[model samples]
Target: MKIIKDDLAGTEIKALLQEHLDDMYATSPPESVHALDVDALRRPEITFWSAWLESDLVGCIALKSLEPGHGEIKSMRTANIARGKGVAKTLLQHLVEQARSSGLHKLSLETGTQAFFAPARNLYLGYGFKECAPFSDYRLDPNSVFMTKCIKE
Candidate 1:
């Protein structure tokens, strides 16, 4: 799969982001859903990317710069059809490489605590992220679990 920086203007990516948001709201409480929408992913601080197998969209992820040496993972999702493939893994590796290249020393993300999020939690854990306290603008919430990793240079 080819992963490239996306402008977030394609209809396919828009649908994928909507699916991600829909799942976030469906699986977590309204106030606990932290997934960003399409418009939110376009912010200057966030760098978005889309994974594609030829013309079909495989998945997407974004890195949101939080500070001089930190970034928050945002809008990570694999297409329903691409589930079971290594799309998320590839996208994650891509994000980590980009973050490092951008001079970031740490990466963090917030995901739900529900059983529905087990797979996601496992994926992050396998990728070397460890549970941590809320960072950035986040606050402690029972429904949310935060993970962070130090990618020191």
Candidate 2:
């Protein structure tokens, strides 16, 4: 599979993002949903990427620069059919490498504390991300779990 930077304008990618948003809303309360829409992902601070297997879009992920040496993981999703195929894992590894190469000293993310997000929290934990206080514009919320990993300089 090939992962490339995306413009967030393609029909397939748009549809996939919409699906991701839907899932987020379905799983979390409106106030707790932090997943950005397409327009937000297109901002200069965010670098979006899609994983493609030939012509099919397999998954997508984004890295958002939070500061000079910090980044956040956003919009990580694998197509329904692509789940269990390591698409998310591969994309995450790719993002980590990209962040390190870009001179980022750390990477962080916010995910739900609900059962629906358990798998995601586990995935982050497996990658050495530790629970942390909210960073950036985030405020403390019982439904939210913040995680961060320090990258070797």
Candidate 3:
């Protein structure tokens, strides 16, 4: 599988993002859902990528610049059929490498604190992310958990 920067205009990607949003809403309260939609991910500050296995889209992730050397992870999701296949691992590694190359010193993300988000939380923890207080414009929320990692440049 290969990771490619995406334009967020393809039907497949849109569907995937919608599925991601739906799952987020299903798992967390509306006030706690931070997953961005297609239009939000298309903004200039966000760089979105899609993981493809041949012609199939397996997973996706985005990096949104928060400051000169900091970024926030957004819209991470793997296709249902692609779970347990290391699709998210590969995509995350790609984003980490891309962040390092782009001079980003930190990467942070917010996810649900519910049981439905256990796998995702574990994935980030396994990737070296540590739990942290809310960053940027985020405030404390019972339904949300924040994680961050500092990249070595």
Scored by Cα lDDT, where does model 1 land? 0.94
**Candidate 1 lDDT for residue 48:** 98
Positional deviation of 44 in candidate 3, in angstroms?
Answer: 0.6
Clashing pairs in 1: none
Worst 10 residues of 3 by lDDT: 24-33
Off by over 4 Å in 3: none
lDDT of 3: 0.93
Query: lDDT by residue for model 3 over 1-153, one digit each (tens)?
Result: 988999988999999999999998888888888999888888999999999999999999999999799999999999998999999999899999999999999999998888988999999999999999999999999999999999985
Model 2: ten consecutive residues of lowest lDDT: 80-89
TM-score of 1: 0.98
lDDT of each: 0.94, 0.96, 0.93
Clashing pairs in 3: none
Q: Write the per-residue lDDT of candidate 2 for residues 1-153, one digit (tens) a residue.
A: 999999998999999999999999999889999999999999999999999999999999999999899999999999998888999899999999999999998999999999989989999999999999999999999989999999875
Q: How many backbone clashes does candidate 2 have?
A: 0
Query: Which pairs clash (backbone N, Cα, C closer than 3 Å) in model 2?
Result: none
RMSD, candidate 2, Å: 0.8
